[model samples]
Target: SGSFVVAVDTDVMGRGSEELGKTLMKGFLFAVSQLPSLPKTVLFYNGGAHLTCQGSASLEDINALADKGVDIRTCGTCLNFYGLTDKLEVGSVTNMYEIVETLAQAGKVVKP
Candidate 1:
């Protein structure tokens, strides 16, 4: 087991135009990527899963995190429900069982 921080990106941040929201999300991910000790994993569910899929504005940053050894996982059920399974571009697909276990074993679980 290892330390972990969970990022639950629910609405792309802020409350305004979708364009602004997307920009904010990109900035957030970029900041996260600059962290010295990055999170062990990033779990995306619900709308957050969109950040790990095709056409995401923050895909480059997310891909950087993945290259740095972060476990980027998007909810499998969510992708299917949202019809984005084939559109995924980063990370791996994960189920609730693993999600629950990962969160439970994490040293710090952060929802953002």
Candidate 2:
């Protein structure tokens, strides 16, 4: 099987009101989690770091992916920059090298 990756670089799915964007994002992750073919990994970076942190509405969905063996990784630099270092809720901290390598090795990459 060709394993894919999900890279989320922002908390919102698109440009617009933050509130609505977040709702869309939550729906997106939920849908992803229910996919018949699960992804190999889900990478969170930049503003997307918020999705893996405490108080994030997407935690349940993200955690569901994790329970199914999805590798959830958050950019260490981004988490620190966002002051969410201690708030990471569902993944391990990752570096640029690992991020690049994971993407490079993936059969396909999905970003949303």
Clashing residue pairs in all predictions, respectively, total 0, 0
TM-scores across all candidates?
0.89, 0.96
What's the TM for model 2?
0.96
Root mean square deviation (Cα) for candidate 1: 1.9
Indicate the worst ten consecutive residues by lDDT in candidate 1: 1-10
Q: Which digits, one per residue and each the tens of the lDDT, describe model 2 over residues 2-96?
A: 39999999999988898999999999999999999999999999999999999999999999999988899999999999999999999799999
Best by TM-score: 2
User: For residue 82, what is the lDDT in candidate 2?
Assistant: 98
| lDDT string, candidate 1, 1-112, tens digits | 2386766656477787887877777888888889888899999999998889888888999999999999999999999989999999999999999999888888998775
Cα lDDT for residue 67, model 2?
A: 91
What overall lDDT, based on C-alpha atoms, would model 2 receive against the true structure? 0.94
